[model samples]
Target: MPSGSVALSARPEIIGGPPPGAATLEARDACAWFGDRLVLEGVDLVMPKGKVTALIGPSGCGKSTFLRLLNRMHELIPGAALDGEILLDGNDIYAVGTRAQQVRMRIGMVFQKPNPFPAMSIRENVLAGLKLARLKCDDKDTLVEQSLLRAGLWKEVRDRLDSPGGALSGGQQQRLCIARSLAVYPNVLLMDEPCSALDPTSTRRVEETIDELRGEVTVVIVTHNMQQAHRVSDLCAFFLAEENQPGFVVEQGDTLEMFSSPRDPRTLDYVEGRFG
Candidate 1:
């Protein structure tokens, strides 16, 4: 562990320098609409399995919308419709008879807010994903420890696994949510502004967890914080949506290179803080 970094060695299975997942993801000419309003269009992206990809842009640019589209989450909205195909390892996730629940099982999600089930204990929260998937683990205690360790929360709450998840501080609750997401062993994790509500220390811990998850799980994140994007991502895509125009990919590439030398003026401006 580096100086100032929290120790996260309790679960050595997820020490990620390179991704170690089984499938890759690609979106070809993807488009989305909320009833009669078009929010995103002509979107294409490829996120390699076991790597971290960051989606950064101004608010309302469809970053979160695109993240939700990956697992058919948008279908939950009435009158919501989409165009194009999102593929997981060359297989269309939207193919007929494919269950949305199954797709979500393989690609888990962590939202911006720390939304631990209020009535559940920390241990229960950590194992929530498995329950949602209707899977049972024989070694429940071990699973909780490993998941919390992977989320960088094991040491603090190891002795109080039965405490209500909502009783935790905002940061701890967020990490608990992360632990819950990891418990299911999803191949890809989708995060929408995961650190938006945390303090600096909490944000750093979450970032470390994301770093460690590399090679163990593919992570796609939407963020307004460019610094966070540059730190945790292997690759990045800049999205833009202007008045009367649907959101589209402005540019994308290696994170370091994209920040240091962007191909488009808008990319350079956004990265340099000239404009969002």
Candidate 2:
């Protein structure tokens, strides 16, 4: 959470998972603040199960903030706090006894930059989460191979599973990061500008991986690139930061409709390149 000058007018109530015409993940009246300043206000959204939802907005509009909040990553920042209900499969993640560690294990994240454990090998990185969870594995090697194959990196690095994770290209490193997330068998994946630092070829490869991941896990991505959002998402949420208020959701709908027939004029403007 960070200080911003946008606020939401209406506060939408919590709608649990699988509501009538609803999606898998829902957030109701979610408000976030860092210290005294509000960043998100009365925001609401639904992400369909096994489908990709893209969050698009200008920088500082709280797109990334909201993405992090979906899985409680916002709390990792100093002085970050929020009010709202985030539901996953009808369970309120903020309820008492709800463990953030368990939430993280089920909802994985990939950052703007590739981050693999430098000291670990490719094989080791894929099994890191399982090890952290203290899962006993009589044949951990099978899990590693399956995870790498699912991540689309096994063929590229099969000969060198023992090689250090740092030795791969930027794209490969990001894939390794994804493989690490997959090792935990998460139900949802949150990506924060995951391909911003990658080149076109690398970006394509990552996009391909995302395409393949659909139907396996719910995906929510925060991205500034409109084309990329259009390319990968089935649903879209638009956010904006306005004067004297915290950032808020402007509109959310089917990806094609949001682009072709946005309800808010501001959303139309942002998507049509009238203003970022």
Candidate 3:
């Protein structure tokens, strides 16, 4: 097994049929670049199964880049390249014969912005992933309801299933995106500042959804919001890059410990509003 990779164990039952089973994601000696410029280097971290891990750092520290690497999204950028292994359940996702599409299916992503197909109805938006992945569901109605319920948006939009997804409020749209991701039943969910674009109420709702999904999906979120990170995450990793240097992990541990008793001065400074 790669360093930081944990053995899989039996998963508890979840709402959407037999659990897809949460997975431990491990990055080993991970380095990323855009063309010839090294942006992130030597990052090794373990995202434990069925827990929320927050990547908290200042802007331009490569937190988003690192999150993209886990699901093979990094390769989508022109001139983007990465070194080292990203392990899912101890298997290398970047290994030969491993298809990018398959990796993405197992590891779904929710972006910084809510991106629902504006023309698609709410029901269609939720089932979009299944259609794109060629996954068949015996009962689409039940799946939609279950997904929306899990995302904490079912009651609000239950009667408006036929409404255009874009017609919903910003927070509702974001939760709809979460429902879409959940419909595919991914083992690991990657969120990039999921609540950054929402109002406070919407942010709270999204955070509530994140808390509810804990222990059912392994979640890795990148956030500049320290308070949100502390509230929603079980583990935290702090990344830092000095002047003209490649970004790297400065500290990582339990969320409470990282906030209350961080060993590194940089972490303390960043967390206490001293500096990024």
Q: Count the backbone clashes (under 3 Å) in each candidate.
A: 4, 5, 0
Q: Give the whole-model CA lDDT for all candidates, comma-separated.
A: 0.86, 0.81, 0.90
lDDT of 2 by residue, 74-126 (tens): 99999999999999887898889988877777788999999999889999888
lDDT of 3 at 20: 80
The model with the greater TM-score, 1 or 2, is 1
Ranking by lDDT: 3, 1, 2
Clashes of 3: 0
Reference-based lDDT, residue 228, model 3: 96
**C-alpha TM-scores of all predictions:** 0.92, 0.89, 0.93
RMSD of each: 4.1, 9.8, 5.5
Best TM-score goes to which candidate? 3
Error at 13, model 1, angstroms: 14
Colliding residue pairs in candidate 3: none
lDDT of 1 by residue, 1-276 (tens): 433222333333422111225368899999999999999999999999878999999888999999999989999999999999999888898999988988887788999999999899999998787777777666678778878887889999999999999999999999999889877667789999999999999999999999888877789999999899999999999999988888999998999999998999999999888877
* Model 3 lowest lDDT segment of ten: 2-11
At residue 72, what lDDT does model 2 achieve? 88
